[model samples]
Target: QTDHYNLLKRSGRAKATTESEDKFLRVNSLRDRWLIEQQLQAQLNTGRSQQVSVSTVKRRLRAAGLTGRVTKKRLVWATKHRQWTTEDWKTVLWTDEIFGSSYRVFHSLQTWFVASTVSSLGL
Candidate 1:
């Protein structure tokens, strides 16, 4: 069974990268099964090979660990950018490459009032 799978993979029938025309071909965004099928067709439309079937495409994606999940973009917002200012400090959504999602809000400014000039006789 493993041998057969390997054969298919090598023959561009089990691996998504088999249709590598421009170095490598892959479906990045798999929003739906049908969409993925369409994408595979488009990717294999070089007219130099057999069209990959929906099941084959799906199997290849599974083999490659490409599941149907929206991969959120990770960003280190303040690392190279300015610190969050008071006017822009409302809410924050953060993520990292380590598969983490964090939501936070910060209030870094504080205000205080004091009677620095107290009247001697209740002015």
Candidate 2:
């Protein structure tokens, strides 16, 4: 982040964090993906100007497993996209078990699990 900050500064494109061109334009699809991953209603509200359609934001959120409602514009998944098969759930569990205790040699397993899940999924 520091490196990218420096690059942005040198490139003369830097703006206030709230209204940075990077936030509005430079980030592109990845920004939408990230916003959906975050799923913060307030952040979504603030990120886009008032005139931006709610449907556009909802579209991105739905794609990123952040929304469940079906709208006439898009087909709804039979289930939320984040729902995994039993086998997939088992894999997620095993991965969590193996690494959950190792995040910090000091943090408790449960704490690490919550923190890691939140940080990794950007929830």
Candidate 3:
């Protein structure tokens, strides 16, 4: 009898990226969470004739459990202190060392923030 399962398994086309390329993409993505798929694709395409699509880059990233999220706007502290005078500023405590995490979100015609996960970044 002819085996149908083996025949069925061999039907689809090969993936665009190889194992090494996928690993490179994942490592770069983890290293720089803000990198977009287009940029990643461009980097991957450099020095190679075979170019991968942005969607393919996105798919590879998604497979590695990375997703894009929009960063929420924080309350503007400067606005609250806008009316404060020199005397008011002197009354506040000043610290030479700052202890807090900071992540800058750049905005342009479109905004996209990429992170491994919401829980990972504690967002």
Candidate 4:
């Protein structure tokens, strides 16, 4: 429930020779928190204003205690260890045989095929 701009403004409002440094850290922390909640994969730097290099960004994020926060996401089907064995895919099947070229296309179809077939048998 922290107000980012307000927090930064308050922190930067501190009397210091280098108030910008404080402001940058505050802003960067806010950005990092936002990126975390949004589940973004990129690491954010408090020092970069489109002027900082990638290496500098990495350093800044590390300095901010955010290095461990950098994470990579897995695919929907990916396993925990990322190593897949044949047994893991035993439930899967691939059929090269084609059923037919085409089947009847039904529109708004709602026939009780099972009941009708049963009744047709006169049982």
- Highest TM-score against the true fold, candidate: 3
RMSD to native, candidate 3: 7.3
| Tens digits of per-residue lDDT for model 4, 7-120 | 333434432213454345435544544333112212332333543344544344454445332222222234364576788667668677464222323221111111234556
Q: Model 3 clash pairs?
A: none
| Rank order (by lDDT, best first) | 3, 1, 4, 2
**Candidate 1: segments with Cα more than 4 A from true spot:** 1-23, 27-35, 69-123
**Candidate 4 deviant stretches above 4 angstroms:** 1-26, 32-50, 73-123
Return the lDDT, model 4, position 26: 37
Cα deviation at 95, candidate 2, in Å, is 26
- When summed lDDT is taken over every stretch of 10 residues in candidate 4, the lowest stretch is 106-115
Relative to the unseen true structure, what is the C-alpha lDDT of residue 15 in candidate 4, on a scale of 0 to 100? 28
Better model by TM-score, 2 or 4?
Answer: 4
Clashes of each: 0, 0, 0, 0
- For lDDT, candidate 2 versus 4, the one ahead is 4
lDDT of 1 by residue, 1-123 (tens): 655643333433344345443222233333232244446556656574666566765555555445443221113344444676766654545454455332422222111112223463465
**Each candidate's lDDT (Cα)?**
0.42, 0.36, 0.71, 0.38
| Pairs in steric clash, model 2 | none
User: How much lDDT does candidate 3 score?
Assistant: 0.71
Candidate 3 residue-wise lDDT, 1-123, digit = tens? 655544356567898899999999988887876666778899999988888999998888778766654333323454567799999989988878565443544441112344556887888
TM-score of each: 0.31, 0.20, 0.54, 0.26
